[model samples]
Target: MTQYPHSPENPMCQHQPVCPSAEATDREAARIIACFPEQGWSLLCNGVIVFEDTGELLPDGSSIAPHRGPARHALAA
Candidate 1:
Protein backbone atom coordinates (compact mmCIF):
# COMPACT_ATOMS: atom_id res chain seq x y z
CA MET A 1 0.00 0.00 0.00
CA THR A 2 1.16 3.53 -0.70
CA GLN A 3 2.35 5.29 2.43
CA TYR A 4 3.00 8.72 0.98
CA PRO A 5 0.60 11.53 1.72
CA HIS A 6 -0.65 11.80 -1.84
CA SER A 7 -4.35 11.84 -2.55
CA PRO A 8 -6.01 8.44 -2.54
CA GLU A 9 -7.93 9.22 -5.71
CA ASN A 10 -4.63 9.79 -7.55
CA PRO A 11 -2.36 7.66 -5.48
CA MET A 12 1.03 7.03 -6.96
CA CYS A 13 0.85 3.83 -8.89
CA GLN A 14 3.32 1.38 -7.42
CA HIS A 15 3.30 -1.22 -10.08
CA GLN A 16 6.70 -1.79 -11.60
CA PRO A 17 7.68 -3.52 -14.79
CA VAL A 18 7.49 -7.29 -14.54
CA CYS A 19 8.28 -8.19 -18.11
CA PRO A 20 7.55 -5.70 -20.90
CA SER A 21 9.70 -2.65 -20.49
CA ALA A 22 9.42 0.40 -22.73
CA GLU A 23 11.48 -1.26 -25.46
CA ALA A 24 9.38 -4.39 -25.20
CA THR A 25 6.24 -2.31 -25.28
CA ASP A 26 7.48 -0.69 -28.47
CA ARG A 27 8.41 -3.98 -30.07
CA GLU A 28 5.11 -5.56 -29.15
CA ALA A 29 3.26 -2.51 -30.41
CA ALA A 30 5.09 -2.70 -33.72
CA ARG A 31 4.34 -6.37 -34.08
CA ILE A 32 0.67 -5.82 -33.36
CA ILE A 33 0.43 -2.99 -35.86
CA ALA A 34 2.31 -4.94 -38.52
CA CYS A 35 -0.11 -7.79 -38.26
CA PHE A 36 -3.13 -6.20 -36.69
CA PRO A 37 -6.51 -7.85 -37.00
CA GLU A 38 -8.73 -6.35 -39.72
CA GLN A 39 -10.70 -4.20 -37.35
CA GLY A 40 -7.78 -2.77 -35.40
CA TRP A 41 -6.06 -0.69 -38.02
CA SER A 42 -6.85 2.36 -40.12
CA LEU A 43 -4.85 3.52 -43.10
CA LEU A 44 -4.91 7.28 -43.24
CA CYS A 45 -5.05 9.11 -46.55
CA ASN A 46 -1.43 10.11 -46.12
CA GLY A 47 -0.52 6.52 -45.28
CA VAL A 48 -0.15 6.98 -41.56
CA ILE A 49 -1.74 4.35 -39.37
CA VAL A 50 -4.15 5.30 -36.65
CA PHE A 51 -5.45 2.98 -33.98
CA GLU A 52 -9.19 2.77 -33.51
CA ASP A 53 -9.71 1.45 -30.04
CA THR A 54 -8.41 3.87 -27.39
CA GLY A 55 -7.41 6.66 -29.78
CA GLU A 56 -3.85 6.56 -28.53
CA LEU A 57 -1.72 7.28 -31.58
CA LEU A 58 0.75 4.50 -32.14
CA PRO A 59 4.32 5.58 -31.64
CA ASP A 60 5.42 4.07 -34.95
CA GLY A 61 2.35 5.49 -36.71
CA SER A 62 -0.04 2.70 -35.72
CA SER A 63 -1.59 1.39 -32.58
CA ILE A 64 -1.51 -1.67 -30.38
CA ALA A 65 -5.01 -3.13 -30.44
CA PRO A 66 -6.75 -3.30 -27.13
CA HIS A 67 -6.66 -6.76 -25.56
CA ARG A 68 -10.30 -7.62 -24.84
CA GLY A 69 -12.57 -6.17 -27.52
CA PRO A 70 -13.48 -7.74 -30.85
CA ALA A 71 -11.43 -4.85 -32.28
CA ARG A 72 -12.18 -1.34 -33.45
CA HIS A 73 -14.16 -0.24 -36.46
CA ALA A 74 -12.67 1.93 -39.18
CA LEU A 75 -11.39 5.27 -38.05
CA ALA A 76 -13.69 8.22 -38.53
CA ALA A 77 -12.76 10.72 -41.15
Candidate 2:
Protein backbone atom coordinates (compact mmCIF):
# COMPACT_ATOMS: atom_id res chain seq x y z
CA MET A 1 0.00 0.00 0.00
CA THR A 2 2.60 2.51 -1.02
CA GLN A 3 1.04 5.96 -1.07
CA TYR A 4 2.08 8.92 -3.21
CA PRO A 5 2.61 12.25 -1.49
CA HIS A 6 0.02 14.16 -3.55
CA SER A 7 -2.57 11.40 -3.44
CA PRO A 8 -5.59 11.79 -1.19
CA GLU A 9 -6.63 9.85 1.91
CA ASN A 10 -7.75 7.02 -0.33
CA PRO A 11 -6.51 6.11 -3.85
CA MET A 12 -9.36 3.70 -4.26
CA CYS A 13 -11.03 4.50 -7.52
CA GLN A 14 -11.41 3.31 -11.10
CA HIS A 15 -11.40 6.71 -12.76
CA GLN A 16 -8.63 9.16 -11.85
CA PRO A 17 -8.12 12.38 -13.79
CA VAL A 18 -4.79 13.85 -14.89
CA CYS A 19 -3.87 16.91 -12.82
CA PRO A 20 -4.09 20.21 -14.64
CA SER A 21 -2.81 22.25 -11.73
CA ALA A 22 0.06 24.64 -11.32
CA GLU A 23 2.08 21.94 -9.61
CA ALA A 24 2.09 19.74 -12.67
CA THR A 25 4.75 21.18 -14.96
CA ASP A 26 5.31 18.42 -17.52
CA ARG A 27 3.70 15.45 -19.22
CA GLU A 28 6.18 13.09 -17.62
CA ALA A 29 5.21 13.48 -13.94
CA ALA A 30 1.50 13.29 -14.82
CA ARG A 31 -0.05 15.15 -11.93
CA ILE A 32 -3.81 14.79 -11.90
CA ILE A 33 -7.06 15.89 -10.26
CA ALA A 34 -9.49 13.02 -10.18
CA CYS A 35 -13.23 13.16 -9.55
CA PHE A 36 -14.84 10.05 -8.14
CA PRO A 37 -18.43 9.97 -9.28
CA GLU A 38 -19.29 6.91 -7.23
CA GLN A 39 -17.67 7.77 -3.91
CA GLY A 40 -18.30 11.47 -4.43
CA TRP A 41 -14.79 12.71 -3.83
CA SER A 42 -11.82 14.28 -5.57
CA LEU A 43 -8.05 13.85 -5.39
CA LEU A 44 -4.99 15.81 -6.50
CA CYS A 45 -1.73 14.06 -7.15
CA ASN A 46 1.09 13.11 -9.51
CA GLY A 47 1.72 9.64 -10.84
CA VAL A 48 2.84 7.62 -13.83
CA ILE A 49 0.77 8.73 -16.79
CA VAL A 50 -0.64 5.37 -17.73
CA PHE A 51 -3.33 6.70 -19.98
CA GLU A 52 -4.52 10.16 -20.92
CA ASP A 53 -7.63 10.60 -23.08
CA THR A 54 -8.04 13.98 -24.74
CA GLY A 55 -6.06 15.52 -21.87
CA GLU A 56 -8.30 13.87 -19.27
CA LEU A 57 -7.47 11.05 -16.92
CA LEU A 58 -9.60 7.98 -17.40
CA PRO A 59 -10.23 5.38 -14.69
CA ASP A 60 -7.16 3.92 -13.03
CA GLY A 61 -7.95 0.37 -14.03
CA SER A 62 -8.88 1.53 -17.47
CA SER A 63 -5.32 0.95 -18.55
CA ILE A 64 -4.07 -2.18 -16.84
CA ALA A 65 -0.64 -3.47 -17.75
CA PRO A 66 -0.59 -6.82 -19.42
CA HIS A 67 0.73 -9.60 -17.24
CA ARG A 68 4.11 -11.01 -18.21
CA GLY A 69 4.98 -14.67 -17.99
CA PRO A 70 8.27 -16.17 -16.74
CA ALA A 71 10.16 -14.59 -19.63
CA ARG A 72 12.84 -12.02 -18.84
CA HIS A 73 13.80 -8.91 -20.81
CA ALA A 74 17.52 -9.10 -19.97
CA LEU A 75 19.68 -10.90 -22.50
CA ALA A 76 22.75 -12.83 -21.38
CA ALA A 77 25.65 -11.92 -23.60
Candidate 3:
Protein backbone atom coordinates (compact mmCIF):
# COMPACT_ATOMS: atom_id res chain seq x y z
CA MET A 1 0.00 0.00 0.00
CA THR A 2 1.31 3.45 -0.86
CA GLN A 3 1.09 6.42 1.49
CA TYR A 4 0.55 10.03 0.64
CA PRO A 5 3.11 12.63 1.70
CA HIS A 6 0.60 14.44 3.92
CA SER A 7 -1.53 11.74 5.45
CA PRO A 8 -2.88 11.90 9.02
CA GLU A 9 0.08 9.96 10.40
CA ASN A 10 2.51 12.23 8.57
CA PRO A 11 0.62 15.41 9.63
CA MET A 12 2.38 17.73 7.21
CA CYS A 13 -0.04 19.55 4.94
CA GLN A 14 1.61 20.09 1.55
CA HIS A 15 -0.74 22.94 0.62
CA GLN A 16 -0.22 24.70 3.92
CA PRO A 17 2.70 23.55 6.03
CA VAL A 18 1.71 25.96 8.80
CA CYS A 19 -2.02 25.17 8.64
CA PRO A 20 -2.02 24.00 12.23
CA SER A 21 -0.51 27.23 13.48
CA ALA A 22 -2.52 29.51 11.24
CA GLU A 23 -5.79 31.11 12.28
CA ALA A 24 -8.81 30.33 10.13
CA THR A 25 -11.82 32.58 9.69
CA ASP A 26 -15.33 31.94 8.42
CA ARG A 27 -16.44 32.39 4.81
CA GLU A 28 -17.77 35.83 5.68
CA ALA A 29 -14.25 36.92 6.51
CA ALA A 30 -12.45 34.74 3.99
CA ARG A 31 -13.09 34.09 0.35
CA ILE A 32 -13.63 30.38 -0.07
CA ILE A 33 -13.85 28.56 -3.37
CA ALA A 34 -15.71 25.59 -1.90
CA CYS A 35 -15.68 23.33 1.17
CA PHE A 36 -17.23 20.07 2.34
CA PRO A 37 -16.05 19.42 5.89
CA GLU A 38 -18.25 16.38 6.35
CA GLN A 39 -16.64 14.79 3.30
CA GLY A 40 -13.23 16.31 4.05
CA TRP A 41 -13.18 17.96 0.67
CA SER A 42 -13.13 21.23 -1.24
CA LEU A 43 -13.36 22.41 -4.83
CA LEU A 44 -10.71 24.26 -6.81
CA CYS A 45 -11.16 27.18 -9.17
CA ASN A 46 -11.46 24.98 -12.25
CA GLY A 47 -14.11 22.77 -10.57
CA VAL A 48 -11.64 20.28 -9.17
CA ILE A 49 -12.53 18.86 -5.80
CA VAL A 50 -9.47 18.42 -3.59
CA PHE A 51 -9.94 16.30 -0.55
CA GLU A 52 -8.12 16.11 2.76
CA ASP A 53 -7.87 12.41 2.14
CA THR A 54 -5.45 13.26 -0.67
CA GLY A 55 -7.96 12.56 -3.40
CA GLU A 56 -9.02 14.88 -6.20
CA LEU A 57 -12.05 15.20 -8.50
CA LEU A 58 -10.88 17.06 -11.55
CA PRO A 59 -12.82 19.58 -13.62
CA ASP A 60 -13.04 17.09 -16.45
CA GLY A 61 -14.83 14.62 -14.16
CA SER A 62 -11.65 12.59 -13.77
CA SER A 63 -10.26 11.49 -10.45
CA ILE A 64 -6.70 11.61 -9.16
CA ALA A 65 -6.63 9.84 -5.86
CA PRO A 66 -3.92 9.59 -3.25
CA HIS A 67 -1.58 6.60 -2.86
CA ARG A 68 -1.40 6.62 -6.63
CA GLY A 69 0.97 9.47 -5.76
CA PRO A 70 0.87 13.12 -6.69
CA ALA A 71 2.10 14.14 -10.12
CA ARG A 72 5.03 16.09 -8.67
CA HIS A 73 6.20 13.08 -6.67
CA ALA A 74 6.07 10.86 -9.71
CA LEU A 75 7.99 13.39 -11.78
CA ALA A 76 10.60 13.79 -9.07
CA ALA A 77 11.02 10.07 -8.67
What root-mean-square deviation over C-alphas does model 3 reach?
15.3
Backbone collisions counted per model = 0, 7, 0
Residue 61 of model 3 has an lDDT of: 71
Order by TM-score, highest first: 3, 1, 2
Please give, for residues 1-77, the per-residue lDDT of candidate 3 as tens digits. Answer: 54436535223333333222112221122223678899798754334456787666654576765644557868988
Please provide TM-scores, in order, for all candidate models, with all chains considered together: 0.22, 0.18, 0.42
The alpha-carbon deviation from the true structure for residue 51 of candidate 1, after best TM-score superposition, in angstroms, is: 1.3
Error of 1 at 47 (Å): 2.1
Candidate 2, clashing residue pairs? 14-59, 14-60, 15-59, 18-32, 19-31, 19-32, 19-33
Question: What's the candidate order when arranged by decreasing lDDT?
Answer: 3, 2, 1
Runs of candidate 3 exceeding 4 Å displacement: 1-32, 67-77
Least lDDT summed over 10 consecutive residues: which range in candidate 1? Answer: 13-22
State the TM-score for model 2: 0.18
